[model samples]
Target chain A: DAGITQSPRYKITETGRQVTLMCHQTWSHSYMFWYRQDLGHGLRLIYYSAAADITDKGEVPDGYVVSRSKTENFPLTLESATRSQTSVYFCASSESFHSYNEQFFGPGTRLTVL
Target chain B: AQTVTQSQPEMSVQEAETVTLSCTYDTSESDYYLFWYKQPPSRQMILVIRQEAYKQQNATENRFSVNFQKAAKSFSLKISDSQLGDAAMYFCAYRRRVNTNAGKSTFGDGTTLTVKP
Candidate 1:
Protein backbone atom coordinates (compact mmCIF):
# COMPACT_ATOMS: atom_id res chain seq x y z
CA ASP A 1 0.00 0.00 0.00
CA ALA A 2 2.92 2.34 0.60
CA GLY A 3 4.62 1.69 -2.75
CA ILE A 4 3.55 0.99 -6.31
CA THR A 5 0.96 -1.71 -7.10
CA GLN A 6 -0.48 -3.31 -10.21
CA SER A 7 -3.95 -4.74 -10.65
CA PRO A 8 -4.79 -8.11 -12.25
CA ARG A 9 -1.47 -9.68 -11.35
CA TYR A 10 -2.32 -12.29 -13.98
CA LYS A 11 -4.66 -11.97 -16.94
CA ILE A 12 -5.88 -14.02 -19.90
CA THR A 13 -7.70 -12.54 -22.87
CA GLU A 14 -8.61 -13.48 -26.40
CA THR A 15 -7.23 -11.83 -29.51
CA GLY A 16 -8.72 -8.49 -30.60
CA ARG A 17 -10.11 -7.91 -27.13
CA GLN A 18 -9.49 -4.77 -25.12
CA VAL A 19 -7.85 -4.92 -21.71
CA THR A 20 -6.40 -2.38 -19.33
CA LEU A 21 -3.69 -2.94 -16.73
CA MET A 22 -3.83 -0.58 -13.80
CA CYS A 23 -0.89 0.81 -11.88
CA HIS A 24 -1.10 2.93 -8.74
CA GLN A 25 1.58 4.49 -6.61
CA THR A 26 1.40 6.10 -3.20
CA TRP A 27 4.69 7.97 -3.44
CA SER A 28 3.26 10.76 -5.57
CA HIS A 29 6.28 10.57 -7.80
CA SER A 30 6.31 12.90 -10.78
CA TYR A 31 7.42 10.35 -13.36
CA MET A 32 5.69 7.02 -14.05
CA PHE A 33 6.57 4.47 -16.70
CA TRP A 34 5.09 1.39 -18.39
CA TYR A 35 7.27 -1.38 -19.72
CA ARG A 36 6.83 -4.89 -21.12
CA GLN A 37 9.21 -7.70 -20.39
CA ASP A 38 9.54 -10.28 -23.15
CA LEU A 39 11.87 -13.16 -23.78
CA GLY A 40 15.07 -12.22 -25.66
CA HIS A 41 14.08 -8.55 -25.65
CA GLY A 42 14.39 -7.89 -21.91
CA LEU A 43 12.26 -5.04 -20.63
CA ARG A 44 11.25 -2.50 -23.25
CA LEU A 45 9.59 0.75 -22.26
CA ILE A 46 6.18 1.40 -23.79
CA TYR A 47 5.23 4.79 -22.40
CA TYR A 48 6.26 7.23 -19.70
CA SER A 49 4.49 10.12 -18.08
CA ALA A 50 6.55 13.03 -16.81
CA ALA A 51 3.63 14.29 -14.77
CA ALA A 52 -0.10 14.18 -14.61
CA ASP A 53 -1.52 14.98 -18.08
CA ILE A 54 1.90 14.66 -19.73
CA THR A 55 2.96 11.42 -21.39
CA ASP A 56 5.45 10.35 -24.05
CA LYS A 57 6.22 7.24 -26.13
CA GLY A 58 9.16 4.97 -25.52
CA GLU A 59 11.06 2.41 -27.59
CA VAL A 60 8.13 0.00 -28.13
CA PRO A 61 4.86 1.94 -28.19
CA ASP A 62 3.07 0.85 -31.37
CA GLY A 63 0.37 -1.42 -29.89
CA TYR A 64 0.06 0.05 -26.42
CA VAL A 65 -1.60 3.13 -25.02
CA VAL A 66 -1.09 4.84 -21.65
CA SER A 67 -2.66 7.70 -19.74
CA ARG A 68 -1.80 9.55 -16.55
CA SER A 69 -4.73 11.70 -15.53
CA LYS A 70 -3.55 11.64 -11.91
CA THR A 71 -0.09 11.61 -10.43
CA GLU A 72 -0.77 8.43 -8.48
CA ASN A 73 -2.24 6.42 -11.35
CA PHE A 74 -0.88 5.34 -14.75
CA PRO A 75 -2.83 2.75 -16.67
CA LEU A 76 -1.82 0.90 -19.83
CA THR A 77 -4.41 -0.22 -22.35
CA LEU A 78 -4.22 -2.80 -25.08
CA GLU A 79 -6.97 -1.86 -27.53
CA SER A 80 -6.59 -4.94 -29.70
CA ALA A 81 -4.81 -7.71 -27.92
CA THR A 82 -2.55 -9.89 -30.04
CA ARG A 83 -0.38 -12.89 -29.20
CA SER A 84 2.68 -10.72 -29.65
CA GLN A 85 1.35 -8.40 -26.96
CA THR A 86 1.43 -11.12 -24.31
CA SER A 87 4.15 -10.33 -21.80
CA VAL A 88 4.82 -9.22 -18.24
CA TYR A 89 3.97 -5.56 -17.88
CA PHE A 90 5.72 -3.49 -15.24
CA CYS A 91 4.99 -0.04 -13.83
CA ALA A 92 7.70 2.13 -12.36
CA SER A 93 7.87 5.49 -10.64
CA SER A 94 10.55 8.00 -9.79
CA GLU A 95 10.70 11.34 -8.07
CA SER A 96 11.66 13.21 -11.21
CA PHE A 97 13.00 12.88 -14.74
CA HIS A 98 16.58 12.74 -13.45
CA SER A 99 18.85 9.87 -14.39
CA TYR A 100 20.17 9.34 -10.85
CA ASN A 101 16.83 8.71 -9.21
CA GLU A 102 16.04 5.04 -8.66
CA GLN A 103 12.79 3.70 -10.02
CA PHE A 104 10.34 1.93 -7.79
CA PHE A 105 8.65 -0.98 -9.59
CA GLY A 106 5.31 -2.63 -9.13
CA PRO A 107 4.70 -6.34 -8.73
CA GLY A 108 4.09 -6.55 -12.49
CA THR A 109 1.11 -7.90 -14.48
CA ARG A 110 1.44 -11.08 -16.48
CA LEU A 111 -0.97 -10.98 -19.41
CA THR A 112 -1.60 -13.77 -21.87
CA VAL A 113 -3.29 -13.19 -25.19
CA LEU A 114 -4.82 -16.26 -26.75
CA ALA B 1 20.12 5.44 -29.67
CA GLN B 2 21.83 3.57 -26.85
CA THR B 3 22.03 -0.19 -26.38
CA VAL B 4 22.92 -2.36 -23.40
CA THR B 5 24.21 -5.90 -23.75
CA GLN B 6 24.66 -8.62 -21.13
CA SER B 7 26.95 -11.16 -22.72
CA GLN B 8 26.34 -13.97 -20.25
CA PRO B 9 23.05 -15.69 -20.68
CA GLU B 10 23.53 -17.56 -17.40
CA MET B 11 26.06 -17.82 -14.59
CA SER B 12 26.53 -19.84 -11.42
CA VAL B 13 28.59 -19.45 -8.28
CA GLN B 14 28.99 -21.55 -5.19
CA GLU B 15 27.65 -20.08 -2.01
CA ALA B 16 30.21 -17.85 -0.35
CA GLU B 17 32.10 -17.45 -3.60
CA THR B 18 32.33 -14.50 -5.92
CA VAL B 19 31.08 -14.09 -9.49
CA THR B 20 31.01 -11.33 -12.02
CA LEU B 21 28.49 -10.74 -14.80
CA SER B 22 29.64 -8.84 -17.86
CA CYS B 23 27.78 -6.01 -19.57
CA THR B 24 28.64 -3.76 -22.50
CA TYR B 25 26.95 -0.77 -24.08
CA ASP B 26 27.15 1.36 -27.20
CA THR B 27 26.65 5.04 -26.65
CA SER B 28 28.08 8.30 -27.92
CA GLU B 29 26.82 10.43 -25.07
CA SER B 30 29.42 11.49 -22.52
CA ASP B 31 27.09 11.81 -19.54
CA TYR B 32 24.83 8.94 -18.54
CA TYR B 33 23.95 6.59 -15.73
CA LEU B 34 24.17 2.82 -15.51
CA PHE B 35 22.32 0.46 -13.23
CA TRP B 36 21.88 -3.18 -12.34
CA TYR B 37 18.49 -4.62 -11.48
CA LYS B 38 17.69 -7.98 -9.97
CA GLN B 39 14.49 -9.84 -10.74
CA PRO B 40 13.81 -12.81 -8.53
CA PRO B 41 11.25 -15.59 -8.99
CA SER B 42 8.55 -13.28 -7.64
CA ARG B 43 9.00 -11.01 -10.69
CA GLN B 44 9.80 -7.83 -8.81
CA MET B 45 12.48 -5.64 -10.30
CA ILE B 46 14.88 -4.58 -7.55
CA LEU B 47 17.66 -2.09 -8.07
CA VAL B 48 20.93 -3.68 -7.04
CA ILE B 49 23.40 -0.91 -7.78
CA ARG B 50 23.98 2.21 -9.85
CA GLN B 51 26.99 4.03 -11.30
CA GLU B 52 27.44 7.44 -12.84
CA ALA B 53 29.62 7.82 -15.89
CA TYR B 54 31.28 10.92 -14.49
CA LYS B 55 32.49 9.13 -11.39
CA GLN B 56 35.74 7.22 -11.73
CA GLN B 57 35.09 5.11 -8.64
CA ASN B 58 32.78 2.14 -8.90
CA ALA B 59 29.64 1.80 -6.81
CA THR B 60 29.34 -0.82 -4.09
CA GLU B 61 26.46 -1.91 -1.94
CA ASN B 62 26.98 -4.60 0.65
CA ARG B 63 27.66 -7.74 -1.39
CA PHE B 64 27.08 -6.12 -4.75
CA SER B 65 29.49 -3.86 -6.61
CA VAL B 66 29.92 -2.53 -10.12
CA ASN B 67 33.03 -2.12 -12.28
CA PHE B 68 32.35 0.85 -14.50
CA GLN B 69 34.69 1.54 -17.39
CA LYS B 70 33.62 4.74 -19.07
CA ALA B 71 36.13 4.58 -21.91
CA ALA B 72 35.36 0.98 -22.82
CA LYS B 73 31.63 1.53 -22.20
CA SER B 74 31.53 -1.52 -19.98
CA PHE B 75 29.66 -1.97 -16.72
CA SER B 76 29.95 -5.29 -14.96
CA LEU B 77 28.35 -6.46 -11.74
CA LYS B 78 30.34 -8.41 -9.19
CA ILE B 79 28.61 -10.36 -6.46
CA SER B 80 30.61 -11.41 -3.45
CA ASP B 81 29.67 -14.03 -0.86
CA SER B 82 26.91 -15.29 -3.08
CA GLN B 83 23.92 -16.77 -1.36
CA LEU B 84 20.87 -18.75 -2.42
CA GLY B 85 18.86 -15.58 -2.23
CA ASP B 86 21.10 -14.07 -4.86
CA ALA B 87 19.72 -16.33 -7.56
CA ALA B 88 17.85 -14.21 -10.00
CA MET B 89 17.87 -12.62 -13.44
CA TYR B 90 20.20 -9.61 -13.40
CA PHE B 91 19.72 -6.84 -15.91
CA CYS B 92 22.09 -4.08 -16.95
CA ALA B 93 20.50 -0.79 -17.88
CA TYR B 94 21.58 2.61 -19.25
CA ARG B 95 20.03 6.09 -19.15
CA ARG B 96 21.35 9.30 -20.63
CA ARG B 97 21.65 12.34 -18.36
CA VAL B 98 20.21 14.69 -20.97
CA ASN B 99 16.67 15.91 -20.48
CA THR B 100 15.46 14.34 -23.72
CA ASN B 101 16.65 10.91 -22.64
CA ALA B 102 15.91 11.13 -18.95
CA GLY B 103 13.56 8.63 -17.31
CA LYS B 104 13.99 6.23 -20.23
CA SER B 105 16.29 3.31 -19.50
CA THR B 106 17.59 0.80 -22.03
CA PHE B 107 17.87 -2.64 -20.49
CA GLY B 108 19.94 -5.60 -21.54
CA ASP B 109 18.64 -9.10 -22.25
CA GLY B 110 19.63 -10.06 -18.67
CA THR B 111 21.75 -12.84 -17.24
CA THR B 112 20.19 -15.54 -15.10
CA LEU B 113 22.45 -16.08 -12.10
CA THR B 114 22.22 -19.25 -10.03
CA VAL B 115 23.82 -19.75 -6.64
CA LYS B 116 24.90 -23.25 -5.67
CA PRO B 117 24.90 -24.28 -2.06
Candidate 2:
Protein backbone atom coordinates (compact mmCIF):
# COMPACT_ATOMS: atom_id res chain seq x y z
CA ASP A 1 0.00 0.00 0.00
CA ALA A 2 2.94 2.31 0.62
CA GLY A 3 4.92 1.42 -2.51
CA ILE A 4 4.60 2.84 -6.00
CA THR A 5 1.89 1.46 -8.30
CA GLN A 6 1.47 1.64 -12.08
CA SER A 7 -1.80 1.12 -13.89
CA PRO A 8 -2.51 -0.91 -17.03
CA ARG A 9 0.37 -3.33 -16.49
CA TYR A 10 -0.03 -4.52 -20.08
CA LYS A 11 -1.21 -2.46 -23.00
CA ILE A 12 -1.40 -2.68 -26.79
CA THR A 13 -2.01 0.39 -28.91
CA GLU A 14 -1.92 1.52 -32.52
CA THR A 15 0.39 4.02 -34.09
CA GLY A 16 -0.81 7.63 -34.00
CA ARG A 17 -3.11 6.74 -31.15
CA GLN A 18 -2.96 8.54 -27.86
CA VAL A 19 -2.13 6.52 -24.73
CA THR A 20 -1.53 7.51 -21.15
CA LEU A 21 0.29 5.57 -18.43
CA MET A 22 -0.51 6.32 -14.83
CA CYS A 23 1.81 6.20 -11.81
CA HIS A 24 0.90 6.63 -8.19
CA GLN A 25 2.86 6.58 -4.98
CA THR A 26 1.68 6.64 -1.38
CA TRP A 27 5.08 7.58 0.09
CA SER A 28 4.65 11.30 -0.60
CA HIS A 29 8.10 11.41 -2.19
CA SER A 30 9.33 14.75 -3.42
CA TYR A 31 10.68 13.45 -6.73
CA MET A 32 9.24 11.18 -9.40
CA PHE A 33 10.62 9.81 -12.68
CA TRP A 34 9.62 7.93 -15.82
CA TYR A 35 11.95 5.59 -17.71
CA ARG A 36 11.74 3.24 -20.66
CA GLN A 37 13.71 0.02 -21.01
CA ASP A 38 14.78 -1.14 -24.42
CA LEU A 39 16.78 -4.11 -25.57
CA GLY A 40 20.56 -3.47 -25.56
CA HIS A 41 19.94 0.18 -24.68
CA GLY A 42 18.84 -0.41 -21.07
CA LEU A 43 16.67 1.94 -19.03
CA ARG A 44 16.65 5.53 -20.26
CA LEU A 45 15.00 8.42 -18.49
CA ILE A 46 12.11 9.99 -20.38
CA TYR A 47 11.06 12.63 -17.88
CA TYR A 48 11.32 13.48 -14.21
CA SER A 49 9.87 15.85 -11.65
CA ALA A 50 11.50 17.67 -8.76
CA ALA A 51 8.15 18.36 -7.19
CA ALA A 52 4.57 18.95 -8.16
CA ASP A 53 4.37 21.38 -11.11
CA ILE A 54 8.14 21.01 -11.82
CA THR A 55 9.21 18.66 -14.61
CA ASP A 56 12.27 18.29 -16.84
CA LYS A 57 13.37 16.26 -19.81
CA GLY A 58 15.77 13.35 -19.59
CA GLU A 59 17.98 11.73 -22.23
CA VAL A 60 15.03 10.63 -24.38
CA PRO A 61 12.03 12.83 -23.73
CA ASP A 62 10.83 13.29 -27.28
CA GLY A 63 7.24 12.38 -28.19
CA TYR A 64 6.31 12.09 -24.54
CA VAL A 65 4.44 14.46 -22.29
CA VAL A 66 4.27 14.30 -18.51
CA SER A 67 2.33 16.33 -15.92
CA ARG A 68 2.51 16.34 -12.17
CA SER A 69 -0.69 18.02 -11.10
CA LYS A 70 -0.30 16.54 -7.62
CA THR A 71 2.64 15.26 -5.59
CA GLU A 72 1.31 11.68 -5.45
CA ASN A 73 0.67 11.31 -9.16
CA PHE A 74 2.81 11.66 -12.32
CA PRO A 75 1.21 10.56 -15.55
CA LEU A 76 2.85 10.07 -18.98
CA THR A 77 1.03 10.65 -22.20
CA LEU A 78 2.12 9.62 -25.66
CA GLU A 79 0.24 12.08 -27.84
CA SER A 80 0.87 10.00 -30.96
CA ALA A 81 2.21 6.58 -30.18
CA THR A 82 4.72 5.03 -32.52
CA ARG A 83 5.99 1.48 -32.88
CA SER A 84 9.33 2.67 -31.64
CA GLN A 85 7.67 3.67 -28.37
CA THR A 86 6.96 0.04 -27.54
CA SER A 87 8.84 -0.75 -24.38
CA VAL A 88 8.44 -1.35 -20.65
CA TYR A 89 7.78 1.89 -18.81
CA PHE A 90 8.72 2.32 -15.20
CA CYS A 91 7.90 4.88 -12.53
CA ALA A 92 10.10 5.63 -9.60
CA SER A 93 10.11 7.94 -6.60
CA SER A 94 12.60 9.17 -4.06
CA GLU A 95 12.30 10.82 -0.70
CA SER A 96 14.16 13.97 -1.73
CA PHE A 97 15.93 15.60 -4.61
CA HIS A 98 19.25 14.01 -3.71
CA SER A 99 20.40 11.35 -6.14
CA TYR A 100 22.00 9.07 -3.58
CA ASN A 101 18.79 8.24 -1.82
CA GLU A 102 17.21 4.88 -2.56
CA GLN A 103 14.42 5.03 -5.13
CA PHE A 104 11.28 2.92 -5.12
CA PHE A 105 10.20 1.62 -8.54
CA GLY A 106 6.80 0.49 -9.71
CA PRO A 107 6.11 -2.89 -11.29
CA GLY A 108 6.30 -1.26 -14.76
CA THR A 109 3.90 -1.10 -17.69
CA ARG A 110 4.61 -3.07 -20.83
CA LEU A 111 3.28 -1.18 -23.84
CA THR A 112 3.21 -2.51 -27.36
CA VAL A 113 2.55 -0.18 -30.30
CA LEU A 114 1.45 -1.92 -33.41
CA ALA B 1 25.43 14.72 -19.80
CA GLN B 2 26.37 11.78 -17.56
CA THR B 3 26.93 8.39 -19.15
CA VAL B 4 27.11 5.06 -17.33
CA THR B 5 28.55 2.00 -19.03
CA GLN B 6 28.51 -1.64 -18.02
CA SER B 7 31.34 -3.21 -20.01
CA GLN B 8 30.28 -6.82 -19.57
CA PRO B 9 26.94 -7.70 -20.99
CA GLU B 10 26.90 -11.18 -19.48
CA MET B 11 28.93 -13.19 -17.01
CA SER B 12 28.81 -16.61 -15.35
CA VAL B 13 30.22 -17.87 -12.09
CA GLN B 14 30.05 -21.11 -10.15
CA GLU B 15 27.93 -21.20 -7.08
CA ALA B 16 29.71 -20.08 -3.92
CA GLU B 17 32.37 -18.37 -6.04
CA THR B 18 32.98 -14.68 -6.24
CA VAL B 19 32.10 -12.59 -9.24
CA THR B 20 32.69 -8.99 -10.20
CA LEU B 21 30.69 -6.73 -12.50
CA SER B 22 32.43 -3.70 -13.95
CA CYS B 23 30.93 -0.25 -14.44
CA THR B 24 32.35 3.05 -15.69
CA TYR B 25 30.80 6.51 -15.85
CA ASP B 26 31.62 9.86 -17.42
CA THR B 27 30.63 13.03 -15.64
CA SER B 28 31.92 16.59 -15.70
CA GLU B 29 30.82 17.29 -12.16
CA SER B 30 33.21 16.47 -9.34
CA ASP B 31 30.42 15.69 -6.92
CA TYR B 32 28.08 12.83 -7.75
CA TYR B 33 26.77 9.45 -6.67
CA LEU B 34 27.02 5.85 -7.91
CA PHE B 35 24.69 2.92 -7.40
CA TRP B 36 24.08 -0.72 -8.31
CA TYR B 37 20.62 -2.20 -8.71
CA LYS B 38 19.58 -5.80 -9.24
CA GLN B 39 16.62 -6.97 -11.28
CA PRO B 40 15.77 -10.64 -11.16
CA PRO B 41 13.43 -12.67 -13.35
CA SER B 42 10.48 -11.07 -11.59
CA ARG B 43 11.63 -7.68 -12.86
CA GLN B 44 11.53 -6.17 -9.43
CA MET B 45 14.18 -3.51 -9.01
CA ILE B 46 16.32 -4.01 -5.93
CA LEU B 47 19.12 -1.82 -4.63
CA VAL B 48 22.49 -3.47 -4.04
CA ILE B 49 24.89 -0.71 -3.10
CA ARG B 50 25.65 2.99 -3.33
CA GLN B 51 28.71 5.23 -3.10
CA GLU B 52 29.22 8.95 -2.85
CA ALA B 53 31.97 10.50 -4.94
CA TYR B 54 33.35 12.41 -1.98
CA LYS B 55 33.60 9.32 0.19
CA GLN B 56 36.92 7.54 0.16
CA GLN B 57 35.54 4.35 1.63
CA ASN B 58 33.81 1.77 -0.43
CA ALA B 59 30.19 0.82 0.21
CA THR B 60 29.25 -2.65 1.39
CA GLU B 61 25.87 -4.28 1.84
CA ASN B 62 26.02 -7.73 3.34
CA ARG B 63 27.36 -10.08 0.64
CA PHE B 64 27.55 -7.24 -1.87
CA SER B 65 30.37 -4.69 -1.90
CA VAL B 66 31.32 -1.94 -4.29
CA ASN B 67 34.81 -0.94 -5.37
CA PHE B 68 34.29 2.76 -5.91
CA GLN B 69 37.34 4.40 -7.46
CA LYS B 70 36.16 7.97 -7.86
CA ALA B 71 39.40 9.16 -9.45
CA ALA B 72 39.18 6.50 -12.13
CA LYS B 73 35.44 7.01 -12.44
CA SER B 74 35.00 3.29 -12.00
CA PHE B 75 32.42 1.55 -9.82
CA SER B 76 32.41 -2.24 -9.85
CA LEU B 77 30.19 -4.65 -7.93
CA LYS B 78 31.67 -7.68 -6.20
CA ILE B 79 29.53 -10.55 -5.05
CA SER B 80 31.28 -12.86 -2.63
CA ASP B 81 30.10 -16.43 -2.18
CA SER B 82 27.40 -15.89 -4.67
CA GLN B 83 24.25 -17.99 -4.56
CA LEU B 84 22.04 -19.24 -7.37
CA GLY B 85 19.52 -16.62 -6.37
CA ASP B 86 22.03 -13.98 -7.31
CA ALA B 87 21.39 -14.54 -10.99
CA ALA B 88 19.91 -11.35 -12.32
CA MET B 89 20.56 -8.25 -14.35
CA TYR B 90 22.64 -5.70 -12.50
CA PHE B 91 22.74 -2.06 -13.47
CA CYS B 92 25.09 0.75 -12.64
CA ALA B 93 23.61 4.20 -12.20
CA TYR B 94 25.02 7.69 -11.69
CA ARG B 95 23.70 11.06 -10.59
CA ARG B 96 25.08 14.48 -9.77
CA ARG B 97 25.58 15.47 -6.16
CA VAL B 98 24.99 19.15 -6.75
CA ASN B 99 21.27 18.38 -6.79
CA THR B 100 18.65 19.29 -9.39
CA ASN B 101 14.95 19.17 -10.10
CA ALA B 102 15.31 15.89 -11.95
CA GLY B 103 15.45 13.05 -9.47
CA LYS B 104 16.63 10.58 -12.03
CA SER B 105 19.70 8.36 -12.01
CA THR B 106 21.55 7.76 -15.27
CA PHE B 107 21.62 3.98 -15.82
CA GLY B 108 24.04 1.71 -17.61
CA ASP B 109 23.05 -0.94 -20.12
CA GLY B 110 23.20 -3.66 -17.46
CA THR B 111 24.98 -6.98 -16.98
CA THR B 112 23.23 -10.33 -16.68
CA LEU B 113 25.02 -12.53 -14.19
CA THR B 114 24.49 -16.26 -14.12
CA VAL B 115 25.24 -18.37 -11.11
CA LYS B 116 25.88 -21.92 -12.17
CA PRO B 117 25.59 -24.87 -9.83
Q: Which candidate has the highest TM-score of all?
A: 1
lDDT by residue for model 1 (A2-93), tens: 99999999999999999999999999999999999996557999999999999999999998888889999999999999999999999999
Give the distance in Å from residue B53's predicted Cα in candidate 1 to where it truly belongs. 0.1
Clashing pairs in 2: none
- Cα lDDT of model 2 by residue, A1-114, tens digit: 788999999999999999999999999998999999986656888999988999999889999999999999999999999999999999999998766788889999999999
lDDT of 1 at A6: 99
TM-scores for chain B, listed for all candidates:
0.98, 0.96
> lDDT of each model, Cα atoms only?
0.94, 0.91
lDDT of 1 by residue, B1-117 (tens): 899999999999999999999999999989999999999999999999999999999999999999898889999999999999999999999998987657799999999999999
lDDT of model 2 at position A108: 90
| CAPRI rating of model 1 | medium
A-chain TM-score, model 1 = 0.97
State the lDDT of candidate 2 residue by residue for B1-37, as single tens digits: 8899999999999999999999999988898888899
